[model samples]
Target: MSAVTAPTKGTPAHRRSRARGPLLSKRLRMAGLYLAGAAVFLFSVFPVYWMVATAFKPVSEIFSGTPSLLPGTPTLEHFDRVINGELIPGVSFWRFFANSLTVTLASVLMGAVLSLLAAIAVARFRFRLRTAFIMVLLVIQMVPMEAMIISIFINFRQLQDATGVQMLGNLTGILIVYTAVSLPITIMMLRGFVAAVPKELEEAAAIDGAGNWTIFWRILMPLVAPGLVAASIFAFITAWNEFIVALTFLGRSTDYYTLPLTLSYYFGRYGTEWGSIMAASTLLTIPVMIFFLFVQRRMVSGLTMGAVKG
Candidate 1:
């Protein structure tokens, strides 16, 4: 051209077009990511949502040909049915709840303490068969509990026959089993956590006039508390939801039944009581949720504090 044209305040057309292309692509990519995340969330949560919704739905609605996403007329009859001993006569739902609570708490407490001590010893000290011990733990963890159920039952029965300790038809048997089963994994997890901690910290405490007991309790314990918390949660959940062992040991006694065992009564020869089953299932899940909520902050923050700040 004879005369050159000045670039406009809005910028040249090529530059504007180039910027628009990247901006549009970025927005599309962001939108796709959001969509994928939402879809995944919905897929994962649908079953849980359905269970909760079904708990409130009446018998007629639950048995309807077409299912509704929400209850049209929510009712507490199913809850009442479960709580009033209708599901299994002469057995209050609270009894099963209490059984689960006692067993789970005892198992978790004992497991955590024993696991922490063992983990500390393994991670810090050199001893005979140390590598073999760690390998044994790994091997035990690899063996599924189902595979050992028969042997476990036979041994418990034999012990009961010999010692008359009431291994079967009692909570103690399963408590022992759960603690033993959970131990290997808990020890392994805590071992890593203990190893991550610098031995220099303990030495520093010693230099500052700290005794072995004092250094162990005051310094080492706090540093590994996060691992302890994690292992406890695992043990708690294990003992809480254990079914086959509870079923095998508790026998036919409703008094010794756990929450999972109680839910089995909801299915009859005629038809399943979906509403009551859902209600009971919902109640069963509440304690786990409550426990998690109580310790979640500690669980998340403890890791950072123990590793970084300690």
Candidate 2:
């Protein structure tokens, strides 16, 4: 029989080295991942930081050759101009803000209600052309707004000619457009949320003598609230930041211009008012941030929960 050699001291050390190799590799990988994440964070946030910083910088500092990261002497003159100064000839800042708020809120509300109802119909009922309808929604989303802008404008003009009610140069036209534009995606998103809900819950509610409306309000709405919040955010952002549509549809109707339209006034024939532009941009970003912060929790939960199959 062959004699078994006793395990040597180096044998254990060899095993330890092998073990440490993977551990060390894992640690290095983790470190690399953290570094990559930090780089991405800085890249994403730098522009926002610069915009906010520039908004506070005085005109002299804003135009300085050596740009500073932080304003040496932070001033609110730019904000003052944006808030108090009439950027437009007769229109005040609040008018543009109110217009934006109206359009965005109206679009968001209408989109949410319509999307939720449509989602329920699609997800709960087995209707004819259901698959085709879903495919059409996806197709609509794939089409770029720029490609369709001309056709949309012509359609609105034709509608105005036909109905004798102005579709162009008014908030009503843009409100309808914003709501319509947001519908396809919001419907698709809410469809998943609605479908993911167990049908048994609705059945149980019915057994408990809950009517269709009661079941929807009590059982369905709470479960789907997160999705609605998520969809609303999408609609809100789309309407709020929309420039081309607002520019085209409003069409020299300066009285009905949105906040995005106000940014153009800072770009004069000769030079740009960088301070005012940045200040306006900073202000533009605040509402979005506030809205996001308010709904971030539900948004996060909705995104994750909607992915799961019931």
TM-score of each: 0.83, 0.84
Tens-place lDDT per residue, model 1, 1-310, is 1121344434454355446768677557557867999999999989889989999999999999999889999999989988875556777888888888988989899998889889988988999988999899889977988889999999999999999899989788988998898898788778878998898898898999999899878988898888888778867877887888987888777788888877865564224788888898899888778777756754454334346442
List of clashing residue pairs for candidate 2: none
Decoy 2 TM-score against native:
0.84
Model 2: residues >4 Å from true position, as ranges? 1-34, 268-271, 293-310
Candidate 1 clash figure, as a count: 0
lDDT of each: 0.82, 0.85
Clashing pairs in 1: none
What is the alpha-carbon lDDT of model 2 when measured against the actual structure? Answer: 0.85
| Candidate 1 lDDT score relative to the true structure | 0.82
